[model samples]
Target: MIQVENLHHRFLEIEYLRIGEGHTAIIGPNGSGKTTFLKLCAGIELPERGTVTISGKEPRAVNTGWVGEVPDNNLVFRTVADEVASALRFGRVRADEIKPAACAVLSEMGISHLSSRATHTLSGGEKVLVACAAALALPPEILILDETDTHLDRKAAENLETMIQRRPAPCVLQCTQDMDTASRADRVIYFEHGHPRYIGTPEETFSHLYNTEMYPSLWRIAGCI
Candidate 1:
């Protein structure tokens, strides 16, 4: 379980929030603190006030795998296979065992063909997939994505959506602009000016927003405009 109590940041504030298993998507307009919230949850950034915890531990203390908005930001190796295996190497796994481990991870993610490709040469969609593969190599208890769909094409986004739905992690969270993607999540949190304006199922959240002037683009996407 993940809990946030009296959380406060530069542009974010939450009196209390609880997240129990399953997938949750965070959505808001630009600079509404979507990425900031993910960073806080990923343990990359600490909240200046209140508390954020995962399974009784602080976020930074928990094992987390993150895929950021820019795929290149997550790459640490030249080849796809190398990047996938990098986590194991850092964990001090046996050199002989690393290659097989990386291969297995790629196969599990259904991207074995990318193992031989150069990380820098991969297309936008391929990079996202490779980055996801690398993050999952750790098999973290919680997975966080920060606007990973921003650069993906429709097909790539759908492929990513499928991968996310099948993820083995107990908790998965992502920030996105696509209402269609957000609608598929178990729950959606809509933010306004860095504050959580609403939290509920997609139907409930979007149905409310569709009638308001806050999310014009979302209404158009949902064909409610």
Candidate 2:
């Protein structure tokens, strides 16, 4: 669970909010404090005032994995396999165990074929997948996806979504512009300005946003939009 109380940051202000475990989607217009809230949750930025906690612990105290809008920015290794093993190496895992661990993680993510490829040789979508595999390799308790599908095509985006839904992490926070993807979440948070205007199941939240572009396409075909 993630708990926020009287949170205040550069562009975010929330008196209180609690998000339970499972996948939760964060959606809002551009510059609506969505990313700011994500950063706070990821422990990348401390709140100016108030508090944010995950499972009753500060986010910084928990192991967190993150992937952002730009995949290229996430890669710092020469090869995909090395990228996946980077976290393990940083954590001082046995040198001999690195390759097998990296291989296993890549296989689990269905990207074993790309393991030997150079990071610079990968396509944008491939880079995102490699980055995602790297983040998942160390098994974080908190996994954050910050518009990671922004650059993916339909097929790649769907593939990424499948990976997200099947994630090993108990808590997943995804901030995305894709309403279809947002609608698939267990919970939907609708943010406006710097506040979460609505937070509930997708059915409940989308009802409040019926006339808006935020309405999911699935609902549109079903006439809920």
lDDT string, candidate 2, 84-124, tens digits: 99988976889999889889878766789998899999988
Q: Please, what's the RMSD in Å of model 2? A: 1.6
Give the per-residue lDDT digits (tens) of candidate 1, residues 1-225: 889999988878988989888889898888888899889999899999989999989998887889998877878799999899988787688999989988987876678988989999988767888888777776778999888888788876886777666656889998887777777788898988988888887777777787554444645765763
Per lDDT, the best of the predicted structures is 2
What are the models' TM-scores?
0.88, 0.93
lDDT of 1 at 96: 95
What residue pairs are clashing in model 1?
none
After superposition, candidate 2 runs with Cα above 4 Å error:
none
Residue 39 in model 2: shift from native, Å?
Answer: 0.9
TM-score of 2: 0.93
Model 1 stretches with alpha carbons more than 4 Å out: 91-97, 212-225
